[model samples]
Target: MASPRDPSKRTPEIESWMNGADKLERLLDRDKFKAWGFVIYRCTYRSDSEWEEFIVRIHKRVEEYLGYYNGLDLVGSFAPTVLEDRSFEGATVISLREKFNEWAVTAIKEEQGIDPSHLWHLKNGRYRFFIMVDQEALDSVLSTPEDDIHEGFVRLVNAEWKPEELDEEELAERGGPGPEEEPLEGCTEEDVGWMKVCWGHSQMPGYLQLDGSFDWDMYYSRPPVIQSLS
Candidate 1:
């Protein structure tokens, strides 16, 4: 057998970029990735264009090279959010964790750094961050393969009526049902009709918190729109 190699050969410089322990994904426990099916990337960028470019490029990379296995999508979180003239001010976002492909994310980051004249080198720690999910909430949703789907549907149908209205109707149908009986407890009747429109609608609960991240500025600015993927 060959002699064992010395640990001295492992350079933090090479490992930092290649292995990307400097990358937040390296710091994450592997189970986090497997469980969540995604990760959050929180970073700061100086210019509005930098933010735009990062979002566009990440979307491009996923569309061109990634697939369902990655389950990748993005949100521009906390944008138009800036400190008073900090060198870099960027938003956080959620997407496929780097475990899906080290190079997919690292390559985009590296490419951005290749032409330093265009931008300043940013410390991943100073700029990038991770947002841990509510393990309990995530577990509740994902562990049980079923969703509150029927609950959501019932909510949609009875949104116009008061809670007591549904209760009264049910009691009349069931002949003055006992007070202990409760239908759809812990859930309210509301506008859940959108839930039936798409599978994503069911997942809205997990993602609803991300509504704050929606780039309303994109609509106001009116960038050229794409009618179709083709």
Candidate 2:
């Protein structure tokens, strides 16, 4: 098994998306565009056929990249169930997302011996990925002090998104925000720690809270690159 901290195990798109999403979270200051410093790019294919096609390509591509069993054990484990039914509507998206998140936790714990309850889990929207963290799980560990948890939690999610990265350490060290600095308009001091606090529940509502709605016209209708093996 690759080290629980293997960077090679993560796909490039996921890594790219994570970096972009983390920056967005800090800019937006609400943790609105990310789940654990990463963005889950969702397929917004308009038709059931399009959705199927996208999934098939990902299956082939991911399997080829990570080996058949390896891919199946990761996101592939949840892909079949979502693919079995060709509809990627609101209710279906919610259901599969919840299951995928749960299963990822179990998978990570089994494969790497790391507790995913603290790290963020990615959602594989056959068409569209969500920048959603396991909010309920995060809340459950509010008191998960930085020192007590494994350093791998941050790296496991994304090296760019640890508590130290998001917290006020730099500002504290430098004295504070700039002279003209002001807190985000309506947000509070605690609100700034949106990523750090325990909201006590998965604020993940229906499709809308997380922009959970499906807009089929918006998907990038292309195929993931499939590698050819000798």
Candidate 3:
């Protein structure tokens, strides 16, 4: 499979960001690619610095998996916008609460068909971020069946939305079929089929925890833009 774009080959815009140490700007050149979707999330009760740490960790984790999957790119920002208050709080909380309520009610109705509580207790913290994912990669992962996907690849695409552990042991145990119970007709012991047995874990990106409410806009098609960051 083709590798990710080399940093050495980055465009002039990326070069500028690098020169200025604008990490997010360097990774997310929205004007150059169509967004497959957008994500908004907040951090669990913690300091702003902690939230930034989460962003860095998540970025590194995603980078590791990029080689395992194609068509994926990401860029994120924590800057406050008009929708967000000075503390970077209002917008994300409102949207997450709204979306969570809708989801909870729908789930409850599907199971018991009853009115569900619309309240979502806000967690303590003021860290919020917005991410835009390129369309080609997001669509490919979303349309594929879960059973047919590589665990590591799936984890990369959903890193922010559903933060999952990408451990090799967590993947279904793989091995040749168990020993045959009976011999085929006219087959002797010498005719028994032989199969190789393989074992052990493959390295996987580590786990991450955002620990806050969030929402996904899988159909976002506009050119990537985080107004505040811009």
Candidate 4:
């Protein structure tokens, strides 16, 4: 896989934030990313309900965004305490986190579905959340001009809420296999005879473990952007 974009290669604006020496120093000292690749944020919450509300609001926001760019994977969760040192390399991790937190808090407050009464101490620990883009998918997204990318993100965030409506016929069509049934051609008496011989001497386990390594280089890489929708 391509190494993360070198901080030096970033635009002046991005470079300035990426190379914030003090912030990097502090983050490194904290040993964030020690586990599951995460960084620590000392969040102070007003109450438990507020924390839960924040999560629900962000979940909806992320879902909307993911729908726009089907290729990207934007999953998030709340951790009891922030993980150590999990910021994106060559980027302003803290600033990005703060921006997301601000947006989420504001959205939660404005949306009636979110209840602030459950807000609790982020003081118990910081919550760690993340949004990651597959490099290949990101490359495709970035091929568009920077301005358009920003606009896309905005549209995702401000998307109007709509109730999901299902068409009964369509739903039934997707529900399962058709009413007609067919016999398995490969399971004839001859095939069963060969199978018995093959398995006569040994038993095979039902499952096998898969190694996790995968080829990420095949995908494209692109810079992240935020867009606004009119």
User: Per-residue lDDT tens digits of candidate 2, residues 113-170?
Assistant: 5466533432322212232223232222333442222111100011121122334887
Q: lDDT tens string, model 4, 119-189?
A: 22111111122232222323333344432322221001101111234487776777943333222222211
| lDDT (CA) per prediction | 0.25, 0.29, 0.27, 0.26
Segments of candidate 4 deviating more than 4 angstroms: 1-42, 72-230
Q: List the residue pairs that clash in candidate 3.
A: 71-137
Query: Of models 1 and 3, which has the larger lDDT?
Result: 3
Kindly list the per-residue Cα lDDT of model 1 for residues 55-103, writing each as its tens digit: 3433343333222222223222212111222311231111112221342
Candidate 3: stretches off by over 4 Å: 1-33, 43-45, 69-230
TM-score of 2: 0.25
TM-score of each: 0.18, 0.25, 0.23, 0.19
Each prediction's RMSD over C-alphas, in Å, is 21.1, 18.6, 20.5, 23.1
Query: How many backbone collisions does model 4 have?
Result: 24
Q: Candidate 2 at residue 28, lDDT? A: 30
Scored by lDDT, model 2 comes in at 0.29
